[model samples]
Target chain A: MTTANPQTNETVETIHEETVETNHDDHGHHEQPPKGIMRWILTTNHKDIGTLYLWFSLTMFFIGGAMAMVIRAELFEPGLQLVEPHFFNQMTTVHGLIMVFGAVMPAFTGLANWLVPMMIGAPDMALPRMNNWSFWILPFAFLILLSSLFMEGGGPDFGWTFYAPLSTKYSGDSTALFVFAIHIMGISSIMGAINVIVTIFNLRAPGMTWMKMPLFVWTWLVTAFLLIAVMPVLAGAVTMVLTDKFFGTSFFDAAGGGDPVMFQHIFWFFGHPEVYIMILPAFGIVSAIIPAFSRKKLFGYSSMVYAVASIAILSFVVWAHHMFTTGMPKVALLFFMYCTMLIAVPTGVKVFNWVATMWKGSLSFEPPMLFAVAFVVLFTIGGFSGLMLAMTPADFQYHDTYFVVAHFHYVLVTGAIFSIMAAAYYWLPKWTGHMYSMTLAKWHFWCSVISVNVLFFPMHFLGLAGMPRRIPDYNIQFANVNEIVSIGGFAFGLSQLLFLALVIKCCRGGEKAPAKPWDGAEGLEWEIPSPAPYHSFTTPPEVK
Target chain B: MTASTQSNKKLITYLVLGCLGMFGFGFALVPLYDIMCDTLGINGKTATTAQAYDQQVINKSRTIRIEFMAHIQPGMKWDFGPTTNVLEVHPGELVKTAFVAKNNASKRMIAQAIPSISPGLGAKYFHKTECFCFQQQPVDGQSPADFPLVFFVDPQLPKDIHTLTLSYTLYDITEKTLGEALTGPQAQGVTP
Candidate 1:
């Protein structure tokens, strides 16, 4: 292995020498990253930015999880036991906002940052300095949102959607801060997406054709497009909310010739595609991991690519499915319902492809595989419920109910968050140069898989029983189920600490990992040395 | 610039333009929604102009229940409601009703009432010859203003619908009008 390492290093050095001779005028000088805190602050290295994003997302995950804890604790019984109703509303709102924007989206971007350049055999992300700025913006944006909780009227209480009239006229003074924070977050996302798109387009190694790119790369390409298209729409929505509140312009005010439902229209236009943005990258990560563990090449590579692109395209027309209960005309409702259900086709194609990949192959259940398999099962459950929600008449009953909550958490927590966990476990050895404790990882998985169901499954029953979501208190009948859900929530929350331990232990020191930890894995990323160097592929590799 | 740098510039320009285009589209949804609602006759949005329906055929066979509802938007300090909640009127029969809107604010304000009809399919059939919702109503400080609506349910009204809700949501448009006034040339004479 040592001899093999030196041989590869010699070839890399020769390639670098040749590239330097050819392109001396373009690259200027390559400098080592500065020391200590400033290294993190001033660094434009993709790895450094990727590390920052991962740590930032983990911290936010905990913060959002803590808010979820409060929500569950309050709902443990019939009456408001832990917090005031208004504060409970803020908890639900901020928890959702943080988990979606702060945790899941950034986690995916972090994964993109770490993997995209290496997978494509590029030196680093295109536009690295802008990458730094994009990551740095998130912490401050979230700080503004979190600090709004202490304000006089309290933080955003109208749920994460922040439907207008409630958000504009009746909201606290801190709403301005919420608007600006969201604006900056949107700016950060757009910049990050542009950076990804540019890198994928401009920085691919020689002989790496579009079809030859890995599934992870293909998915990020589509996700970047979705982000660039929709983040601006979110910015516009917030700007309208800002003007409606401060200025006399009545965009959502009916007397001013504006309709409140129009706010939902604009928001979900951005918001629907935004949901796909969070999940498509998860598909990419799972796609990578499933093939690695199953000991097979992916079942239908080009079909998977087409499936993702189709889903992204279909996302735009399905926004109004979120507004079925908002009193849409029958024709509009029917149009939205059919468009939303059409998403199931491409989504089903992805699931079938994954299942087909594992069929008749020697499959191993490593920690990553466990999480990926779970993601497939649970995310499909979420998708099935989503199909149910797409039915216009049925959605009239399910809208704003815990059934909706269960549907999303099944997708997001088990779907997006679980995939992030899978990606982390899948790549931790490569990132840390050491293997994580598998026994502990298995425990974390079992506990999480069991507890997550406990947490979200009963929500379907509660919703079906006519318990509304975003409420602080419920009647006595819901008490028994709420307790079970709370226990699951707490258990799920605690199990993450085990994951934290595993990551920390691995990072500190553990059994050494090889350059390619997984024998079945195939990628440019696996070809590099473990704990990838500060600079990788200074000269792009020949893909063939 | 080198070829790579030139392509980078082109890609960046495309992305930036795409972002701006979508941003503009978000704002454009406001007008697009209005146009869509106007065309589809959905979202309870009533036509602004009075429709010239065929008044010659009076089919007195069916009685349709019309429910009147009023909403006072926040920031508009007013007491507004229909004097009569429900009216039983035969199809093709003209009916008249009054809505009392009182501006309880300390200062006089200009208010606009936008009307919407429920069972949105019924919007085309419901014709208004005269209605307060046709124009903005300016109320003096702390005074009540009575506005009348005159309309007839179309003789060709669909059979499946039993009741239709007609709602008017009132908004304070004083600042908006005043802001426009300040921008216009008329503000120069008033300032002196």
Candidate 2:
């Protein structure tokens, strides 16, 4: 741990300045939060809000993972063993909704909340009171969604995509609850995005130029724009589904001059960018981590920025690739196919740059570095499979198959979720002021990496053999592979518990940490103390 | 308010507007999709109404197969199918066909049929001079109703297309029709 930089000394002085300024605030507490539960409820502190988000995401991760366990247990054999078929569908649907909206999106937002202000030398988010509102609304939203399972018809079983006709005409009574829950979630996301954008645009410390800003900040700025732009489109999608089901607006019913396929078009329009939204911040995290562990300045920083921007821009155009089998015109098929493949160029540039940073450098296999390296390799595999699915002719076979399922899990679980785990390990010491048990982290990593592959990898084979997804029962021919995947699924689910334990142990107390826990780490965050001060940089610090 | 606060207020306003605009755009996509499909002859959508045919441009050399299909949407208690299942005709020749629908329910029911043409590229050339799908049909209890269609394949249809399918999916719109009948004209103070 090194704190040799002169900037660190300047930050220590500013901490005192921040304490003086805290007295002027409405809360009237300096370096200490108000007592009890209301401290979390009413507090506008960014770090406190960040903690709430991370814990909420972790809790959702476990709940969603438990639902996944039910799915895998039922599919453990060819016969339906654990739950009914409809219950299985509900598991799959809610699992997807929880993981996407509940776990991944909020986790990224949580990281932004904690790290963005510290990295950019801002005292707090630009809209602090609104930020509190954003965080508070999320739990109520998920509660509405989860509670719908107990309703007469069970929760949404129409899959996370929730294409029309299935979601509208054939759906259950819980459809209204699902729509309302999604609306609330979208509102939370939009407000959170607005807060991020305003903070970055207005609150950067003097001398922190656009080009010099950290990649995490840069990636988040782009992600925030994406959230603002597309979340509303998702709101529009669910609203139409609501109307078509309840109000007879027929926005997606052909009998009323509306096309069900249009629901897919609008959904993927928002959805494709939503995928990038989950991963782009992961890219920023890996970019930050790889350079640190490699003991080198990141290779091609400008190119990394351009690549993220290009990927975001390309996301909007390539949405219809998801609809290749929907009988679109040949021209649309070709257009979407070409546009989807173009995303690979910028994505490729990012992968190569990460490898280049690690090339011929003093690389160490810390927990963070190990996960970052895995993210690069496995995310590329996912990217290649995405390319395969992007081809019009090939997609005709892969559509709705477990191969499609396998592709996304590789990207999301191994790509986005892995980077999140890496970030937790990298900053845990700084966050909790104690190092997590290294042995436990190693065991957690090895178990997850091996089992996740076993879980998702065989699905590609099952799909290639023509097994469909979202079904609890399959032929005896698939029995062996299904068993293996189920075993892997259980193992992967259990491995996450070790992570929870490690976080708790770290928080309770372990090896004390210094100002900078990693020798090669660079940022304004490292310039401050470990367990970053309650209020940092009330008088903004100059970057240069 | 400070200058920064004022600027933040402006940015927030713009972002809120962007969100509202996108919501409007989502609704607008319904019409925009129709217009694009009509102009591009995509999505297997046929013409909204009848189009005229020129007798002089009939292609005598080519014989084309036109297959008709009718389906009753799920939950609709109506028996429906094409009376003339298939036909062989020269391009630009007028063809008359009929579909029969019987209400299985005890009361009269209003239904609408949506028509689609296969080999979507052939859609622009498959002109319906008159079609039952142009308006909703109300069928009496247990009685079969005959709905007629008059159409022609344009002589300008591509040489490669030798066969096409026209399918109609019928949906029960009785509830919607009844609801509209009560509220539509009467709510607007128009007397029948």
Candidate 3:
């Protein structure tokens, strides 16, 4: 309190005066949060909204995981096993939809809701009510999507990409529901992104200039911009698909002078940036965690920021790499191929920065650190495969194959999802006011690291051996590797239960954590009391 | 009202506008992609209308083998095929080809043909001076109708493209034209 400068004092007074006028209950006192279910339903507090988003995301993760279990179970042998092909297609489509939109995105948003304001020393999210609305609409959107599976002719079997004609002329009635769900999800994302950008721009305490802001906040700023820019494009794509299917328009129909391949162009334009949206926040989270565990300053901090910006810009131009087999002009093909390879440079910069941060520094392996380190190693493998797939000639063999599947799973599962686990472990004590059991945490990390690799590693081989993805049955040649993948899938699915238990046990109570549980941790969030106040920074910290 | 709140309001407006702009950009991509493809002569999109045939530009040394393919889009009950499966012609020599369409449906129908040229680099070079695809053809369903196509390839086509395939997909437009007519000058509460 004594460190407050004149500017900080004036800003705090202005914030307090505004808060008093806006929220009567929050007036200069340690007020209790509201009672009962309404506390969550109508809550404007960032922490409450954060909790809702996290719990919803966890529910979706398991639901999506269970679908993956069905997939692995069916693929265990080869020929026609558990579910019908029609239903298996639905499983893959919905599983991807849920994990991408319902699980990973919401989790990052949840983290932003919890961490951004706290890290920047703000009282709350700038637009708290909008934050609440964003979280609440997500469940309904997902509900509409999940319910469509039982409709006549099953759900959208046209793959998550939903390329035209298959989605237009061939898909079932559930296409409408899928479109509606995507629209709602897009709206939620745009609103959430707007809230994050506004908060980061306007809510930082005095002396917290752009450069002084935490890397997590900086990354979210970029991520929020990506969301704002691309989510609407996705919405536009789904709208065109809907019109093409129902309204007799031919946005994706070739007979009406519209190219079905155009749909792929638009979809991947949104999609490539979207993949970066999922991973950039992971970069921020890992950046924060690695430096904390290594007890060293992050190497090339400014360059890390530049690397992320460059990667995001590159994502917009490199979308056609996904469509190398679509028979684009050779020159166009080469352009996309080289641009796709160019992404690895900035991504390499990030990996090197993380390692350099750990180089010759006092390093200890906490549960969070374990996941972060695993993320660096495994995500690079995914990156290498992605580079291989980026070669226009090699992509002809690998396109739509299990190799493509393995490449993305390595990046998404071990890369994005692993970073999420690292973040959860890293921030659990701060969120819960109690240190988690290291024994349980370590078990979750070890089981996940081993089982996840077993599950996704062989997929590269299956893909390499000429096995296409999204098929209900495979050739006898793929039997052994598929078996290993299935067992690994089951074990990895079960391994998450340990994480579920760890989170629950920590929430209830373990050992009471101090305000800053990790000795090496930094940022305004650490400066706040443990469990993070229901309303953080009633008086903003002087950031000097 | 705080200064930051006022800035937040301004900032939110711009961000939301950016969102809307990107949405429009998504739709814009459709035309932009088409235009880019047309200019580059990619995606196998041939010129929609006929072009002037030039005699002086003829290249006698090049004898391009032009192949034709016909497709009937789903739900259109019509048998459609190219009359000549393949033709060998010197560049700039006007060649006449025809597609036979027999409407098998019980009722009379109107059909439109959409053209695509392969070795997309050769698309712009293949000009249609006169083609039945320029207008919808009315098929009476009793006898097969021959739809004439008149075209000549430009000598400027890439030297590597020795063969070119021009494919036409036939679409049933009876319902669409009928609906438009019912809404337009011809509508007098006509049921069929």
Per candidate, native contacts kept equal 0.73, 0.59, 0.72
lDDT of each: 0.88, 0.89, 0.89
Candidate 1 residues B68-169, lDDT tens each? 999987657899999999999988887889888888988867777888888888887789987888776767788888878889998877898779999988
Ranking of candidates on TM-score, top first: 3, 2, 1
Predicted model with the maximum DockQ? 3
Once fitted onto the true fold, the runs of candidate 1 whose alpha carbons sit more than 4 angstroms away are A1-32, B49-54, B61-63, B73-80, B90-92, B101-111, B138-145, B155-162, B171-192
Question: Model 1: C-alpha RMSD to truth?
Answer: 4.9
TM-score of each: 0.92, 0.95, 0.96
- For candidate 3, write residues B58-156 as lDDT tens digits: 678889999999999887788999988999999989888888888898877777788888877888889998887877676665557878889998888
> Across residues A41-131, which tens digit of lDDT does each residue of candidate 1 receive?
8767788899899999999999999999999989888986779898998999999999999999999999999999999997878777799
TM-score of chain A of 1: 0.95
Error of 1 at A316 (Å): 0.7
Cα error of candidate 1 at position A188, Å: 0.8
Which residue pairs clash in candidate 1?
none
Best candidate, TM-score-wise? Answer: 3
In CAPRI terms, model 2 is classed as acceptable
State in Å the error of residue B129, model 2.
1.4
